[model samples]
Target: MSDRHMICPPKHVAIIMDGNGRWAKARGLPRSMGHRKGVEAVRETVRAAGDLGISYLTLYAFSSENWSRPEAEVNDLMGLLKAFIRRDLAELHRENVRIRIIGDRTNLRGDIMPLLLEAEETTRNNTGITLLIAFNYGARDEMVRAMRRLAAEVAAGTMSPDDITPARVSASLDTSGIPDPDLILRTSGEERLSNFLLWQAAYSELMFLPELWPDFTRETLIHAIERFQRRERRFGGVTAPSLAVGS
Candidate 1:
């Protein structure tokens, strides 16, 4: 591919890893197998993002709505999460990747909380690309939580309703301190956000690819980066005069 996009790589790239079940169904395999394969894709994508110089890579691993899935599948997912951290945490740490978990952690499974904390604590000081895992996360819930915090503050006389600016609201969310994603991608040809990063994705370049999560590779990521580089992010404003159509 072209080296031009490499010169100006996006600082953050977020992905909604979709179509694991469909992928498995297409091959007449158990859905669990698709999730396992998706984990492999996660590993490769993490490594690739670092190599590509992307500063932050946020992955939508589990959504709050995922709780409604079958008990067996939920258990399988929990097991896979535990296994991934146990098996890959050290290598991720060694590579200087900083692990950050977003979403509501207050109600996570009994055995899962410690592992997630360990992953974050272990990599807290790393200076490399931040790998954010969006587990049990929903954008609307994030907003509600943030709003409650502000409302409480206002009611308690700490601040007025006027203090509820966009910046304050943003800082109160789970992704506080992290910049918004430059590109939001979903595989399986899905065009919707599915409640992923609604607030943060306001100006992101949306990309939908036909590949399932299990089929994602470094090359796929590179192509997404190239696509992002080609976008004209006006951010609700006009472009600079130098590039005007009739200039």
Candidate 2:
């Protein structure tokens, strides 16, 4: 590991990239401009994560609720997504960053689905940091979908209801192969999870930053990570007696 990553760095970091619209509004610019700038931040953060030796970085790019946005705004967001993949895919592949998508793909628009699939397929063999994009994703929806799959197994006599453990449920979710996030950061001073990774973030150290998504830079990411390293994660257990009480 590099000296820069010697701190107790998190193995997986998930970010809720928020406040793009607010960022644009504050600057008297169009929301599309904010979104475009946010994409640049995404590229920067990915490079920073790789440099820091972080294994997984999940980005909450778009939620299922975002579909309710105005038609033109939604179109703009989709166009940005397409443009990002087309422009950055080869570079990401060359950098050995594997792309993974964790979200509902059932009813995705025909044009958008192929781009997403291509990103995954092209980078499937990469050995570097895995970039998980949560598009059209909602925590509740993910849980419900996982439960439905388990329920079907029970009905089919392949698994018993009594065998339904937390591990089983986690394995059934869209993030089956991915590790749960060790830290979750939400930009724009948001202090809530906002329906993100509810099941997987049971013990994630959360950092709510005042910076908008478009303003998130490598330094901001490092600061959040340093904050996470300062936290003592007990994961429901108490620390050792020597470490528990203050001396």
lDDT of 2 by residue, 1-247 (tens): 3335455568999999998999999999999999999999999999989988899999998999999999999999999999999999999999999999998999887689999999999999999999999999999999999999999999999999999999999999889988999999999997999889999999888889999999999889888888888888899997778766664
Candidate 1 whole-model C-alpha lDDT, 0 to 1: 0.94
lDDT of 1 by residue, 1-247 (tens): 4343465679999999999999999999999999999999999999988888899999999999999999999999999999999999999999999999999989676789899999999999999999999999999999999999999999999999998999999999999999999999999997999999999999888999999999999989988888888889899988899878988
What's the lDDT for residue 40 in model 2?
95
Candidate that would win on lDDT: 1
Position 186, candidate 2: lDDT: 94
Q: Candidate 1: minimum summed lDDT over ten consecutive residues — where?
A: 1-10
Reference-based TM-score of each model: 0.95, 0.95
Candidate 1, superposed: residue stretches over 4 Å from native = 1-7, 240-247
lDDT of each: 0.94, 0.92
Shift in Å, residue 98, candidate 2: 0.5
What lDDT, from 0 to 1, does candidate 2 have? Answer: 0.92
